[model samples]
Target: MVLRNIMIGIIIIVLVGGIICWTLFSKELREGKNLPLTGVDFKRLADGTYTGTYEGGRFKWRANEVQVTVSSGKVARIALLKSTEGRPSEFTNELYDKVIRSQSLQVDTISGATITSKAYLKAVEDALLKAQK
Candidate 1:
């Protein structure tokens, strides 16, 4: 009987934890989706490197800063300098490739890593916005 009660308590704890996590993550995802993913107008930006940071997502899934290099009025490179995870992941590479290829933040977010992708994009946007001249 004691074992059964312990099992029941464990299940309840798991369920409650799941519910709380879901509520928090769902809210974060909604806010991330609402954030503007507008494309940067590289044409108007000067040729220089710019750094920007954004922390607009859930605590564990946010991009901290992005380093954007613009050259000759084009996006030359993009790098995620910092993130909540403390390092770049495969999603960051994919997102960077898309932005470099398209020269815009209008690229699609990485599947299964939407929040991180958006945070990276937001950081890129912020960096490029500063380069506008």
Candidate 2:
């Protein structure tokens, strides 16, 4: 009877630990999930130069800056400009090509790095809006 209780207790402990881990991981995964970049209308942009920043105002992913330029109603070029202390910004950097190629923010976010993708799109949208003004 004592052995049965011990086994049950161990099982319960393992199950609890698994649940905790899954909860934490899921939250992180969701945050990294591609968030639909809403609230910015991209059609109102006009040809001009603008500057914007993203992931800078948030304490979450820690990427420093993403600067972009648009011309003739298309993404002319993008610059990494700056990044966080030690985090690799390459994956996020590559997203610019995808965004430009698609000519919209509907492209897929980078796997394993969704927050940065959202940040990049946000930054681009911001710059475009400023250019319009």
Candidate 3:
């Protein structure tokens, strides 16, 4: 009888934990999808290297940091310094190239990885904001 009760208790705990994890994951995804990104002006940025970070300010699933190098009043290079994915994923790599190429945050996100692309972009934007004069 005691063993049965223990098993039931374990099951209940597992179910509750699963529910909490799912809820948090869903919330983070929703927040990422609706995240607002203000466009920064490249011409106004100073020539220097800047670092930026974004941790969603709440759920940290998308936490990341990036280094942006500006030269001659333009973004010359960008390096993913840190990320939850251990490094830049294919989507993030592609997105970073797009950001550097266009020099804008208005670039299109990866079709299926919009949240991830935005997460990395947010980090890059955080860094670029510091570059603004």
Question: Of the candidates shown, which would achieve the greatest TM-score relative to the real structure?
Answer: 3
lDDT of each: 0.79, 0.69, 0.80
Which regions of candidate 3 deviate over 4 angstroms? 1-21, 56-59, 87-90, 104-133
Clash count (model 1, backbone only): 0
lDDT of 2 by residue, 41-81 (tens): 45555777666655632335645566678787767777777
lDDT score, residue 94, model 3?
Answer: 83
Residue range 10-79, candidate 1, lDDT tens digits: 9999999999999998998888778786676655789889999887576747657889998877788888
- TM-score-based ranking, best first? 3, 1, 2
Which residue pairs collide in model 3, if any? none
Q: Clashing pairs in model 2?
A: none
For lDDT, candidate 1 versus 3, the one ahead is 3
In model 2, the worst 10-residue window by lDDT is 54-63
Give residue 37's lDDT in candidate 2 (0 to 100). 68
Q: In candidate 1, how many Å is residue 103 off?
A: 2.1
